[model samples]
Target: MFNPSQFHETVQRINTKVPDVQHKASQIDIASVKLANEWFIPEPVARLIIWLKDELIKLVEELMNMMTQVMEGIEAPITMWEDAYKWETVRGIATSVAADVNPSSLGSTGQWTGDAATAYTNAIGPQSTAAAQLATIADSTASSLRSCAEAGLAFYIAVALVVAQFIAAEITAAAGDASVVAAPAGLAAGLAAAATAVGVFVGLVAAIGTLIGTEASQVSTLHGLAVDSTAFPSGRWPVATNI
Candidate 1:
């Protein structure tokens, strides 16, 4: 019952929405790279920047694929429900006949008799269980996608800060070069400045890494909450048929 056309449409919808988020994140990465370049970082840092950008692009593609699968999983149950509902209608009619033919028999116990009861039970119980399981799968998939995205972002941020530090070091080196023509006392000052810059850069990098780790922790928590919120109760299962 799952229409291929509908699945394709849903995948297209997800793909269309993902680009906007990826673009925004990419812009942030570009800005960071520009800032690093302005500070005169070494060539190695620029290479690293390029690597980070490529990784981010890959993450975006993976996210789109994961989302498409999730969307398809979500759609599958609806199609199954539609088919189940049609079958339930026939079951309902048979139940009515069974009830009329055997008033005292358990088979005549209203709609609970015959195929109607079995169909209803299957729809409300097993079908709902399957949906919940699918939701869990989707949730897990989304979580993995988010993890990859966050890791890529964190790597970018760390590399940017390191590049900034390298740039600062280069500036210190330039100052040291100038001090050679100034005074002997200026030599010590230049050395001290470079050391201070290195220390500050190391500390900043450590702090940023810690922050990124914290953000990653929240990703799983958020995903679990999303799954719990979306989990539907079995009672809400649509009537498979009429009685």
Candidate 2:
């Protein structure tokens, strides 16, 4: 007998998980923007970076819902099957978005894994043409993510350089002023500006790195859920395998 209390608890847990996921996703977008502004990335590229981060976060949420269905054992095989279908649907959308961003790297290997990979492979069959197609899409998405990160870094560096130049000019101008004392004020101001630029640059870089790590972890979690949700030898059975 499925305990209603248990089901409620599970739902609550999922709810809790979602906000954390959303927070991280938002952080990724903010970081991307900061980095882009620093590096002077074009408006279009910055917007695209935000879009990619949001989309990935959305996909993760969908995957989590599907996983919950599998855990709840709502209707045994049929419900479980539906859950798998939903996962595939979300993946399809992700892949489509990735293809739109970068097609050449479509289906490149080693970028995604776990539930997404398994669901995709199962949907198209491991050796089928469809699987190959999905692989390409996954590869493209990963590559696009990497490209976005690089663009962010470049933007940050460019801004830092500009700020540094401005500070240098200010210092030189102050040096020629008769009223300007040889005290440490000018030097201190210059140092402060440079320090601020370095701090911003480092923060952006860290954010990009964190986003990548989070994505990888989420992929792994999804995969593990997909694998553990069903009983293998029984062939896609979702009756709480342990019971």
Candidate 3:
């Protein structure tokens, strides 16, 4: 009875200091966490990994964007080819040439316009098909390349520098990961270049195809305008017959 109350007061006094102790402990925990962050690599390498990770992610995104552009580019030449197929000026020229040759034979000559239109459509089909196939290939392959880059970026964080053995293994893994990224990076770039070249080639083919269609129509026009050899003994007919 003499010291029970005294002991109780002492316990309460100790309890008052517990908050301070806890605060100190919390600070220590924070420091430990920071230390853990540098567990496997030195500060420079740690920083480099973060930078490389960000850069690799960016590269992957860039390649994806380029693939989208390449696919869209393929459609442009195809659209041009379609528009050229419907172009009416050449058809009109064919009509005029037909009527000029002989109004009586205009119906027969009109078939030339149909023939040229058919030829123009035929020319565009193969080129457009090829461009579309290339676009599809680029889309699929670039997607694969981006996957490699993403996989490499996954290893960018060097975990717990505190364990030397763990760090060694992680570093090795990171090196392999980096190589994975490097390999696909090259493939994506090459594919972009190839897609660009194919796009240009498609455009050239479309233009040339249109020209060929026009030339074929012109030749048909000349044939229409010519008097048939069968109609004249001299193998030529006069421009006009007796009214």
Cα lDDT, all candidates: 0.44, 0.42, 0.36
Better of 1 and 2 by lDDT: 1
Off by over 4 Å in 2: 1-182, 221-243
TM-score of each: 0.32, 0.30, 0.26
Write down the lDDT that model 3 would get.
Answer: 0.36
Q: Is candidate 1 or candidate 3 better by lDDT?
A: 1
- RMSD for each of the candidates: 16.6, 24.0, 27.2
Candidate with top TM-score is: 1
Backbone atom clashes (below 3 Å) for every candidate: 2, 9, 5
Candidate 1 regions exceeding 4 Å error are 1-113, 116-120, 140-155, 178-197, 204-243
**Window of ten residues with lowest summed lDDT in model 1:** 179-188
Worst 10 residues of 2 by lDDT: 175-184
lDDT of 1 at 172: 37
Q: Let me know the TM-score candidate 2 reaches against the reference structure.
A: 0.30
Candidate 1 clashing pairs, residues 3+ apart or interchain: 85-240, 88-241
> Which model scores highest in lDDT?
1
Q: lDDT for model 1, please.
A: 0.44
Best-to-worst ranking by TM-score? 1, 2, 3
Runs in model 3 lying further than 4 Å from the true structure: 1-38, 65-74, 88-175, 178-243
